[model samples]
Target: MIKSVNCTSFKIERLQTDNGAEFKNTFLSTFLEGCGNIHETSIPYEHHQNGNIEWMDCSISEISQTMLIASCLPKELWPYAFCHAAWIFNRTMHGNDTIAPYEVIAKNKPSLLLLCVFGSKGYLYDHLFQKDLSEKAIFGYHLGEAPHSKGWLFWIPDRKKVLKGASVKFDKNCFIQRIPASTSSLSLIQASSIFDGSMILAIEKQDKLVSSVNVSHDPIHVTPINYREALASAEANEWNIAIEEELTSIN
Candidate 1:
């Protein structure tokens, strides 16, 4: 749970849960209370009070399951599918927000250009220093992206470890499915994208049973507009070269 919390980019303010003894313990109670947080308990037999979160959990589960099934991956990989769902759920437009949760927190427009179908087959170029032209690359499954380094993460069978790198080519046609935009699912997707007090308020009011551990975000790093400018400059240079070639050909 602590590890999960540290993975987020938000500081949990208050916590609310059902009347579970696990949550009513002295250590957790004292810890949260001492930290000046309001810990509220739900009324007995009050599942509706926590409907929002329950619904969100269901949505995440469904998304994870769908991804796994779509990719024909094993059941043991449900956790990875969950992580992928969460990642996509955050980047997707939520409710009224014009931007994604990643954009709101990172303070930049999130780019989906690097996104690959979850669990799709991918290849990473070989880094081997061998002089002979041996096998140039290895095959792997696209796991997810690194939160810190923004590097691509892959599950390499040969390596039996998750590897991170920037160079990767993906075969996304393996698994192609869409997240249906329904009323409830849309709300959950958008609401979960938020990390501000607004989201907490919504969860607390529902008396949700989750110790959503959110971590503090480090820094906001955005690709400068100069990148787009550079693309335009390159296009202009190519046009000039084309024009000069045409004139030289005519001469």
Candidate 2:
């Protein structure tokens, strides 16, 4: 909370939250007291006290769900979808605002040139892992912009990991699909269909990106649930960089 507060340009005189143990802790109280900020709590189960945040949460949830349904990606990837939805929501103009909320907070305009559809077909070029005469690129689904670097973020179903890459190509015509079986392969189906209010031409590519095709039907891992998990992850370096970038952006 202190780190987040320090990033903001404005001074916080008072902070209000629910009567959760996370907020009513000694550690948080000590920090807030040292900062000379007042801490207040609303009655338990009284969600309307935080009306603005509640509305924002509902909006984000709806947007994320719609994105997942359109992409046909599993609900396990909802975190990425939620992040993408929030990113879009922050950049959009709301109410009587002339500029976006991001512009107001960051003091700069957000660019939409690199924005692509969620779960779009992506190809990550593998320079180190590819063998001679082997396929140079592997298929994945586009998640969003990389939080750490200027590259794009992708979810490779085959590797069961999230990665960031600069040399990534996206085929917006194709969408990701999950296979139920253990083995997975990409296939282009020939069909004329309407998807997400847009007319798709004949021979639409339905690339089956294998997420977690276990014989036991286990759940697929999406992302780290906490900082410790992120630090212990295979993409620990990337996550660390992302944490730094997030702090930098709020400042």
Candidate 3:
């Protein structure tokens, strides 16, 4: 974290932490000494001394709650929702002005075009684990934007992990909306058809570049899409990048 801070325009001065052994270890002390930073330890059991972090935690927790209820996604995904909320908050306006926190921190204007709806389902290519294009990419739910990336974060259920990549194929036609599984068996059939992208061509007026799949309900929130549809939406270059990430991962 300090290394990242140093890479930015700001020079290290002081860092404060609660009484945690990880922050007080010999290796950490040596590193802090090398960086010429002053380390301040907060009083034991006095969390109020860290009001800034406490407030930040509370704020993120509230945001997480709102998103979980609004999206009807599982509560286990609170961490992902919190991360997404913070990403949106950092890039978008905070005060009565257009300037954002990201701009202030990075000294550059943050682009809004990269933003996606929170808890929305999106697909990512599976070039790495999958042997060939015959299978195409994997599907996932949008967690938030990838840090230091034009890409987005997604929860990969099979691995039980979150992955960030530029290859996220987002299609609005996808079902992040409410669809109770017990309502109808036809809904399940409909879900399968949507995953196969049969409904996209039949329903929508215009041809979407990609037709997002309907495996939408998960603890992690995911939607898969067809590969052919992805090729058109992702464009050649971005698609290539996705393929490359897979290849690299496999190698």
Q: Model 1 Cα displacement at 205 (Å)? A: 29
Name the TM-score of candidate 1: 0.57
lDDT of 1 by residue, 96-154 (tens): 87888778776677787767777778888767644586876777777676656766777
Each prediction's RMSD over C-alphas, in Å, is 23.9, 17.3, 21.6
Indicate which candidate wins on TM-score: 2
Q: Could you estimate the TM-score for every candidate?
A: 0.57, 0.66, 0.56
- Models sorted by TM-score, best on top: 2, 1, 3
Candidate 2 per-residue C-alpha lDDT over 81-183 given as tens digits, one digit per residue, 9 for 90 to 100? 8888998999998888899988887789998876888888889988668777898888888887776467777777676566778898787666566544442
- Badly placed stretches (over 4 Å) of model 2 are 1-8, 175-251
Task: Give the per-residue Cα lDDT of candidate 1 at 59.
Answer: 72
Model 3 CA lDDT for position 168: 65
Tens-digit lDDT string for candidate 3 (115-187): 7877687788765777644657676777777766778877654444567788767867976775344421233
- Candidate lDDT scores, in order, read 0.60, 0.67, 0.62
